[model samples]
Target chain A: MIKHDLVIVGGGPAGMAAAVAAYDSGVKDVVIIDRDASLGGILQQCIHNGFGLHKLGEELTGPEYASVYEKKVRERNITIYNDMMVTCLTADKIVTAQGSSGILKIQAKAVILAMGCRERSRGALNICGTRPAGIYSAGTAQKLMNCEGYSVGKKVVILGSGDIGLIMARRMTLEGAKVEAVCEIMPYSGGLTRNIVQCLEDYNIPLYLSHTVAEIHGQKRLEGVTIAQVDENRRIIENTKRFIACDTLLLSVGLIPENELTKEAGIPIDNITNGAIVDENRQTLVPGIFACGNVLQVHDLVDYVSDEAELAGNGAAQYILNGGCKGDSVCTEAGNGVRYVLPQRVNTGTGKDVSLFLRVTKPYGKVRFTVKSSENVLAKAVRIKAAPGEMEKITIKADLLNNITEPITVELEEV
Target chain B: MIKNITCIICPKGCSLTAEINEGIVCVNGNTCERGKQYATDECLNPTRTVTSMVRVSNKCNCMVSVKTVKPIPKGKIFETMELIRGAEVCAPVSIGDVILEDVFGTQVIATKNIDR
Candidate 1:
């Protein structure tokens, strides 16, 4: 078995960032294992710009953003194993992976899980349809068009207004395909506001809000799809049905975090985030194991992924250097309009400020985010607008953590 | 005349009012300098960065992603796309390689390296 001080799984933005940060923090024996032949992961297939505006201070394409870290990993002499799929992970930090060369086993003192997430497939939707060609997940269509040069279809109808779906509307249009409509069951789009402007509005593609695809038509190849507006309870209204003729139906429904490794390692998982339960340091319940990026929670942007992975990477390095963080633990709750909050538990003795990342339950105007312990407000921020489509972050000061007498709760309130 | 514009420079999606009486133009409701510029420019001339995939003959299994080196006039989106449509390139194209030059007054360059 090959031994290393730190082993990072999946070399996407999260894994690459973690490896770089861990190496710079005095842990030199770090190795990254990825299932793709390249280190960029999904970013390799994402060709459009809009990443790195926050972290890198410049707008870059997905591949361009990933290249910045890839250069750092290479310059630091960190080892990387590509085209390798991790098959098993143990409680003791043992990783068994299969690659072109066969089974490879690695025993490590610390492991960082950054496997990211997968797209929700048609099986989850269960829409009435004849199994036909030309159906695709938004990301799959993106990969097919961006990475593997192929036009998915001539006439397209997207069944979700998520970022990928919106982006694909513009992409298909630019590739000379006719994008008829983008339907979303939610009243508000799941995509960022800019995507709605640049991807859908700029092209004049109609976005039907509170609507969804009710039925799909076609046998050998997709011929058309029926769309309908949903009621407040999410059931489709029969009178609102409309048929849109198209050769393709692309679904951009949702994403599920890839946490099979965390599960196999016996780490407790959060049903909400569908990721490993982690603390401020991104350390999982398993002493020497950690989770970051999409494996911790699905983020709307890649810039946040790099930032979160840096924490996990530094946490792993500290674990190797100073054993582990053991102290009084306090639980965090998502209250009011909040959906879920990260750092499920915080260490009171860590002597570091904890950043709480979360999403709101729904869209709101003029709001205040409050982080409080029963009696006192720990932190608060006012915003003009807040929505479930965007993740919001706030930092709880360490001094406030030191004086906290009760479990903290992060809540949103309308101002 | 006055027009309302939503700055797409960032996710803020600031709603800006563009006032142009005569040739002098001014914008309001922008949170940032970039948003202000975007609002004014959008009122004057709208533009967008065009990205799409081009077929590769040799690498029949994969397509090469390309984009205009700079933002093109919004009106020219379809015109530029017409130039991109039915176009094919050979495999072994590297990022930054010019796929189509002077495409609707702008160059279309490969954003990724594809090897068959």
Candidate 2:
């Protein structure tokens, strides 16, 4: 058995960033284990641009953004175990991994979970359809085309207006494939407005809001799809059904954080985010186990993932050097038009500002967000618009957390 | 005429209104100077950085992602894509390696590294 101060699972953007931050914060003995042969993770397959505008102050492709972090990890001379799958993690912080050689066991002082997320597939949607060959997840198709050089399909109909679906619509169009339409079950798009404009509108591909693929048609291969409008409750309207002939169907409904290891270790999970519940430092309920990036909450941008990973890294370093974080944490609640707030808890005694990240239950125009602790209002900020597709962040100063005895609640109010 | 434009410069996605009269553009509702510039350029001539993959011969990883070094005219996106579709490169491609030169006055460079 090998011993290390810190072990990060999944050498994606989060793991690489966490390793770098932990090393900088006085934890020099760090190791990263990734199942993939390379360290970039999903970013390697994500070849498009529109990444790193906030964190790096420049527009970059996904691969470029990942290389920045990969370079950092390499320069620090950190140990990286590539093509190794971590099969088990214990409550006592023992990580068991399997590689080409054999099973390897490591006793780690602290562990950071950064497994990222996976795309929701057709099986989860319950769309009535025969199993066909032309169906592919948007991410899968992206990897196939971007990395493997395979032309997925010629005529495509995309379901779900999530960023991946929107991106694929444009990608298919650019590859000389004819994109029929993009349908979303929700009235408002879950994708960023930039994507809506650049990917769909720019290509003249129509986006059907409050619509979905009612039934997928074809047996041996996808022949077409039945599209229909959905009402407020997302039930298909009978008379609004229409058929569009296409050879391919791409599903980009949602993303769920990949946390089998986190759950296996008995860490508490958040139903709304589908990730592990963590504190402001990104530390999970399990001591010495930290969760960040998509494993904590699915973020719309990679820059935010890097930011959250740094917090987890710093928290892990403190946990190792200072012994452990001991204090009563104030619980955070989501209220009134808010879906959920991350870092479900915050340690007020840390004497540092805490940033609360959240999403609105629905889209709103001209509103204000209020962060309160019982009777005391902690912070307030107004926005011209708020959408479920974008994540909102509010930072509460350290001075305001003094002697707070109540659970903090975040709510949205009309401005 | 007044046009509503969604500023894509950042994720804030500030909604901007541009009024174009006799070649002079005035933009409103933008929170920054960059948004104003974006609105003006959008009103006059719009461009986009075209990113796509090109086939790589003689490698297991058969594709490498590439992009124009600068934004090209939005109208030329399809034409540029057609040009990229027929282009091919060999292995040992590094990031920033020129794949297509003088594509609408901008070079198309590899954005990823592919080993031989």
Candidate 3:
């Protein structure tokens, strides 16, 4: 049995950041375990640039961002186990894994789960289609092209305007593929506006909003697809049916936090985020175990993921050093117009301003987000517009939370 | 005469109007200081985030990861990429590691793990 002050699972951005924070915070014995043969998680396959705008203040491709962190980890002499997949986690923070060598057991004083997330594939969508050779998830196609150097197809139709889809459109175009269109069932795109302009508009790829592929028409390989506009109820408007001949279909529908291990560990998972239910300190209901990154919530940018991971890392270190940060935690609730607030519990005694990250339920014009404790408005921020695609952050000073005995709630109201 | 300018700092793409009276720049419609700076720089020069991967040692299967230490002039991607490609490091990395410390005086850090 191996022992460490902090054992981090996943070894992605979240795990690496958490390990660094924990080490820098004074916990020296840190070990990171990952299933991948190497580190970087999903970033390795993401060759197209666009990441690190907020965190690094410069746009970087996935591998570029990951390399900087990897170098830091090496300089720090942090222990890392590659090709090691953690198979079991006990509530007491004992982790068991199987690697290329043999079985490994680790007893950690504190643990941070940075397993990152998984992309949703065709199986999750239940799309009715012949089990053809050409259907691929956008991410899979990206990996095949960017990392493996295999061109997926000559003609492509992307279903879902998620960032992966948009990025892939540009990638395929650059690879000499004729990208026909990117279709989305939602009225709005799930990707950033810049991606739409740079990846689609610049490439002259059409974006059909509020539309979906009604049927996949092919036998052995993709021959064509039928697309139609959807009404408010998402039912296909029969009259708007159009057929596009294509040899490939890529689904960028969505991403779900890979939480099978969390579930297997018996941790309470949030229905909305598909992550663990954690308080402001990023601690799961299970003591000594914390979660961050896409595993906690699907963040739009990697910068946010790094920030969240740092918080979890520091919090985990505090847990290892101070016996845990679970003071008299107060419940934080979401009020009107707000979709959901993370870090559901806040330990005011920690004496740090808590940043609440949330998304609006829908598009709004002229809205104000208010933080209240039933007695007074602690803080508020106004915006000319808000969208579900964008996340909003509001920081509540430690002093404001110190005096509040009741729960804090954040709400948005149309102004 | 009055001219309208927009803050190109973000995708929100806020429009800021500037009134030029006797060669004095009176700016309005800025949502934040970032917007104010963007409005001022939009006319002089525009900048963009630089992102590119650096080559890690063969220990990591010749993979790379990146971060922009700072923003640079717009359309300087290839120039920035040249610097990134030449920089190399041995692996077993961490978050926020300075891979190419001050690449052209820009602090480009790493954001993901790279196995050495």
Candidate 4:
């Protein structure tokens, strides 16, 4: 068995950042294993701009943002194993991977889970339709068009107004294809507001809020789709049904963190975030193991992923050097108007500021968010607007957490 | 005339009201100076940095992502896309390599590296 100081699964943005951070933080022996032929993960196919604004201080395309980290990893002389799929991770930090050559086992002192996320497919939506050839996930179509150099379809109707769906609408239009419409089951769009304007409105594409694809048409290829308005509870309104003729259907409903290995390792999972429950350092319940990026929670921007991964990387380095963390942690709870918060537990004794990342349950205008312990308010901030599509962050100074034994709660008040 | 513009300069997406009168513009509801500049420029002449992928030859990767060096007139986006669609690049392309130069006074440079 090969031994390494740290092993990072998935060579995407998170893994690259974690490896770099860990290497820079006094841990020289680090290895990254990725299932792809090359590094960069999903960023390779994401050719569009609007990435790296916060993290790198420059607006870049997905590939450009990833290249910055890739260069850093290479400069550090860190070892990378491409086309290696990690099949199993043990509670004791043993990682088993299979690649083109053969099966390899590694006994790692610490592990960082950075597997990212996957798109929810048509099967999860349960839209009544015959299996057709023209249906593809927005991400799959993006790879086909951007990387494989293939036009996915001529006439397309997109389901779900998530960023990918909105982006694909613009992409299809840019490629001289007709985008019929984009439908969202929720009253509010799940995508960033900029996407709705730049991707749909810029191209004169109509967005049907509170609507969904009721039935998919065609047997061999996608002929059309039946759309209908949904009630507040998301049930289809039968009378509002209408048919849109299109050769393709793209589903961009949602993304779920890929955590099969995390589960196999028996790490506790959060029901709402669908990710591993982590602490302020991004360390999971398992000692010597950390989780970050989309494996911890789906983030709207890659910048946050890099930042979160750095925390996990530092946490792993500390774990390796100091053996392990020992302290009482204060539990964090999502209070009114909040969906969930990351770093479910905060170590007050760490003597470092803790940033609480969270999302609201729904969209709201002009709100004040308060982070409070039972005894005193820890931090507070106000925003002009808040939405479920966007992740919110609030940092609590370490000095303020002294002698606090109550669970920290994040609650929002509408102004 | 008054127009509402959503500033796409950042994710904050501030909603700005631009009052244009006699070629003079006044913007409100902007939290930063960048937002005011964005609103004024948007009302006068909108621009966008076009990003796309071009065919690559003699590389394991079939396409290399490219983007304009500077934001071009929004009206020129479709035309720029047409020009990009027909463009192809040979292998050993590095990031910042000019794929197509002088595209509306700006160059379309590669955003990704493609090695043969």
Query: Least lDDT summed over 10 consecutive residues: which range in candidate 2 chain A?
Result: A322-331
Tell me how many clashing residue pairs each candidate has. Answer: 4, 0, 26, 0
- lDDT per residue, candidate 4, A86-146, as tens digits? 9999999999999974898999999999999999999999999788899999999999999
Tens-place lDDT digits, model 2, residues A49-96: 989999999999988888899989999979999989999999899999
In model 1, what are the clashing residue pairs, if there are any? A148-B62, A148-B63, A149-B62, A149-B63
DockQ pick, better of 1 and 2: 2
Model 1 Cα lDDT, one tens digit per residue, A204-314: 899999999999999899999999999998899999998989999999998999988889889999999999988888999899999999878999889999999999999
TM-score of chain A of each: 0.99, 0.99, 0.97, 0.99
Q: Rate the local accuracy (lDDT) of all candidates.
A: 0.88, 0.93, 0.80, 0.93
Worst 10-residue stretch by lDDT in candidate 3 chain A? A142-151
User: Would you list the rank order by TM-score, best first?
Assistant: 4, 2, 1, 3
Q: Which 10 consecutive positions of candidate 1 chain A have the poorest summed lDDT? A: A399-408
Report the CAPRI category for model 4: medium
User: Of models 2 and 3, which has the larger TM-score?
Assistant: 2
Where model 2 places Cα greater than 4 Å from the true spot, the runs are none
Scored against the true structure, residue B60 in model 4 reaches a CA lDDT of 57
2 versus 4: better DockQ goes to = 2
In candidate 3, stretches whose alpha carbon ends up further than 4 angstroms from where it belongs are: B1-116
Native A-B contact fraction in model 1:
0.64
lDDT of 3 by residue, A1-415 (tens): 9788888999888888888888899988989999998778887887666668677887566876787677778879699899999999888889999988589998989888888777788777766667778989999988776555567999999999998899889778755689998999998888776677657875689999999988888889999888889999888999999999999999999888988778888899988778999988799999889999999998877778889999998989888899777568788888898888897877876678899999888778889999998877878999887877778889988888777778889999899
